[model samples]
Target: MKKGTLYLIAILWAVIVILPFLWALRISLIPTYTTFVSFFPKSLSELSLVNYEYLLFKTKFPRWMINSVLVSGGATFLNVLACSMLGYVLARKRLPGSNVIFTLVLALLMVPYHILVIALYLGLSKVKLTNTLFGVILPLSANPFGVFLMRQYITMIPREYEEAALVDGCSRIGALFKIVLPQALPAVGILTVTMFMETWNNFILPLVMLTKDSMKTVTVGIADLAFQTLNTNWGVLMAGSLLGAVPTVLVFVLFNRYFLRGLTLHGGLK
Candidate 1:
C-alpha cells in the first residue's frame, strides 16, 4: 500500500511537471483561432505547422537560433575548460591566497547575476561588445558556480592518481590533461549541460546586451516577439518557445547519467 501510494505521488508529480510542456506543444500545433479548452485540438483541420513555418522562415528566428547555439556552446566549452583548470589548481596545488580565492568563488554563488546586469551592461558597452554574440557569451563563460562545482568534483578525485602520473615523469600540465581530466568527465558533463541550459534560457542578460535582432539569442528573440507589438501571435510564440527548448532537452537527455553521477560524488565518498 505504501509503495502504491509513493508511485501514485510520483506519477502526479510527473504530470504536474510535464503538463505545461504538453499544453505548449498542443498550442504550437493547433490553429491560432482554436481555443485551448480540450485535451487536443477540436479537429484535425484545426491543426497545422503554420506557426513553425512562420517562426522558421518569416522572422529573424533562424538567425536567433543560430546565435543561441553558438553562444550556448561557446560559453559551455569555455566555462568547462577554464573551470576544470582552475578547479584542478585549487583542488590539488597549494598556492598563496587559495583559500581567499575559493571563498570568493563561493561568495559569488550567493550573489545573483541579476544584481550585476546594469554594471555588466555598462562595462560591455564601454568595451563596444554590446549588441554582439560575444557580449552575451563572455560574461556568462566564467561563472563562479562552475568553478566551485569543478573544484569540489576535482577534490573528490584521488590525488594518488596525479601522484602516480608525476612519478612516471609527467609534468603537472600533462597529469592534469591526461589523468585528472578523464576522471573529471562526469563533472565536466554536468557543467556543460548546466551552463548550456542557463545560457540558453537566459533572457534578461541577452535582452539588455543585444540591441540588434540579428544577434539576439532565442530567448531574447522570443521575448521580443512578445513585446514587439500589441497583436502577438500566440501560436508562433508557443512554437518558438518549444523549438528553442529542444537543444537543452537534448543535452539533459544525453548527459543525464553523468549529471546524476556528478551529484552523487560525495555520496560514495561518505
Candidate 2:
C-alpha cells in the first residue's frame, strides 16, 4: 500500500473508533432542551453544565456507580480467583473424570447463558438468595470462559516451578500463591478487565437479581432513566451512557497493555 493510502486508512480507522465517542461528548456538552434541536449546537453559546449537574443532583447515579464498582470489582475478584484455581487443577492435576469434566466444560461454553438463566433464577429464588448481591456473584463466580482462559494459560506454565516449590517445602496452596499466581498476574489482569467490563454493563443479571434502587448498578440505572420519558432527552441519555461506559474504557486504557501481553503469554510454562 502507498504511504498516503496507509495514512488514509489510519484516519478512517480512527474516525470509525472515535466518532461515536465524539458525538457523545458533543451531546454531553450541549444544553438539555436545545441539545436535541441540532446536531451541532445552534451557536457556541448554547452549551451548559446542565447534563452533569442533573446527573449528579437528580439521579441516583452516584449510588448506582458505587454499586457498579462494588459489584464489578467483587465479581471480578471472585470469578478470577475461582477460575484460576479450577483452571490450575484441571490443567495440572489428573483426576478420575478429568477428561469427561474437560469435555463438559467446553460443551457448556457452547450453551447460551440466557437459556440457563431461568433455571438458575428459579434455584436462587427457591433458596431465597434472589434479588441480592450474592445472587449476582454466586452464579458468575464459575465463569466458563474464565475457566478456559485460565486452563489454557496454566497449561503453558511449567511443572518445574511447582516441583521446585515442593522441594522448598511449600504446600500446593503455598506454591500456587507464591509461584504460580505471580506468573499468572498478566492473565489475572486480563480476566479482571473482562469480568469488570461484563459486570459493569450487565443489565439482565442485575435486573433479575437486584430489585432495590440502592442495589442497582449503573447500566440498569441508566436504562431506567432512558426507559419511558414522554419526551426522550437524547442529550441526557447520551451523557449518562457515556458516563456508564467510562470506567470500562478507563480500565482498558490503563491495563490494555496487560490485556494485549496476556494474549501472547499463553503456553509459556508447560
Candidate 3:
C-alpha cells in the first residue's frame, strides 16, 4: 500500500476504535432519552450537567467508589505480595512434590470461578464472611495467574543472585524482600493493574457475597442504578459508569510499561 493509503487506514482504524466511547461520552452528557432515541441530540445548542450532578449528588456513588478502591487496592496489594513469594518458591527451590504443587496452581487457571462460587459461599458462611467487604475482596486476591506470571519472570533471573544474597547472610525472607522482590518489580506492576481492574470490575462475586448496599462496589452500584432508577435516568448512570472506568484506565496508562516489560521478558525467555 501507498504511504498515504496506510495513513488513511490507520486513521480510520483509530476512529472505529474510538467511536463507541465518544458516542458514550456524548450520551452521558446528553439527556437520558438518548438511550432509546437511536440518534444523537437534535439540540446541540445546549448541553447540561444534570446527569453528572444527579449521579454525584443523589446517589451513593461516592461510597460505592470508595468501596471499590479499597477492595481492589487491598486485593492487588495482597496478590502482589503473595504471588511474588509463591513465585519465588516455584522458581527456585525444587523440592519433592514441588512440580505437583506448581502444576496444581497452574491448573487453577482453568477452573471457572463460577463453579467455585457456591463452595466459596459455603466456606465463607462457615467463617461468617458473608455480606461483607472482605467477602468481596478475598476471592479476587488469591490470584493463580499472577503467581504463574511472576514465576515465569523469576525463572529468567540468574540463580547466582539468590545464592549470593544467601551467602551474604540474608535469610530467605530477607533475600526475597531485598533482592527477588526488587527484581520482580515489572511483574508486580502488571499484577497490580490487572488484579485491581479485575476486582474493581467484578460484580458477580460481590453480588453473591454482599447482601447489603453499603458494601457495594462500583459495578454492583451501577447495576442497582440501572434497575432502580426509574429507567429514564440512564444518562446519570452512564456518567457514573464513565467515572468508574477512569481510575482503571489511568492506572493502566501510567503502569502499562511495567506490564509490557514483564510479559515480553517472560515470553522471550520461555
By lDDT, who's the top model here?
Answer: 1
lDDT (Cα, tens digit) per residue for candidate 1, span 1-270: 699999999999999999999988888886574553576766788679999999899999999999999999899888988888899889988999999999888777777889999999999999999998999999999988788878988999999988998999999999998999898887777778778878888989998998887899998888887775777788888899899889878877888876566446423332
- Say which candidate scores most in TM-score: 1
lDDT of 3 by residue, 94-119 (tens): 88888998898878877768789999
Off by over 4 Å in 2: 35-45, 260-270
Q: Runs in model 1 with CA error above 4 Å? A: 1-6, 42-45, 163-169, 260-270
| Residue 16, candidate 2: C-alpha displacement in angstroms | 3.7
> What is the lDDT for 115 in model 2?
79
TM-score order of candidates, best first? 1, 2, 3
Cα lDDT of all candidates, in order?
0.85, 0.80, 0.81
lDDT of 2: 0.80
Better of 2 and 3 by TM-score: 2
Q: What tens digits encode model 2's per-residue C-alpha lDDT throughout 50-136?
A: 888888788888888988888888888899889888888898999889878778778877776877888888899999986677788
Residue 163, model 2: lDDT of 92
